[model samples]
Target: MGDELIEKAQELKTMIQNSAEYQKYDSCRHILKEDEELYRKVNEFRKKNFEFQTEGSAENGQADRLAEAYADVLGQKAVMEYMNAELILCRKLQEIYGLLVGDLEFDLDFLQ
Candidate 1:
């Protein structure tokens, strides 16, 4: 059901937000260590869901059109959230890398 899917999506969002890995990215070092795994899981889930949707039928025949629609919406939201987090991590990395490489451009812009 749509309601159940939405609830599950919300629960997943809460879990992601409250995860230790998500909270540990206060510095570039942490981000660098954790971002890859986080992004990989997100991307893998997105790909798997997309592939499942494309398959057009469920083994148990329980996947109705409405259920598919609900799942698609949930998947899209999850992907978007993952992308937003990835972008934030990338920007943090760029700032740190620039500082390390003596590229003052990011420092000037970021510090402002």
Candidate 2:
């Protein structure tokens, strides 16, 4: 399941990397939509894992530890790492978009 999610992330990353729309302001809104979806999934996973931890604590410390470790590996931190990477890519694309559209005042660093 983790592998599948990672694979999906990679696929989305590739799509963004290759998209001409990702290179233009006219489609910046679309890229934001994709980012929003990714963030939504990350938040959903975090919430579900938190709920799991809350509901399963009575099982044993072993299970709780395992879940916590798994969440650490697959939850908010991992998602944030991916988002940081994507932010770099998006910044590059936004640079091109700004140059082409002549809106040089926008800052991409805020996305970080």
Give all candidates' CA lDDT scores.
0.55, 0.59
Q: Residue by residue across 3-98, what tens digits does model 1's lDDT show?
A: 998997788667656655455433333443365765465555556656666885455553454445545443554445555565575576566456
Residue clash pairs of candidate 2: none
Instruction: Tell me the tens digit of each residue's lDDT in model 2 across 1-112.
Output: 9999899778866876666544443244344346676556555655665666789753657556555655644455446455455566668767755665695466779799
Q: Choose the strongest candidate by lDDT.
A: 2
The CA lDDT at 108 in model 1 is 64
Best by TM-score: 1
Predicted candidate 2, C-alpha RMSD: 16.6
Positional deviation of residue 87's Cα in model 1 after best superposition, in angstroms: 0.6
lDDT of 2: 0.59
Which ten-residue region of model 1 has the weakest summed lDDT?
24-33
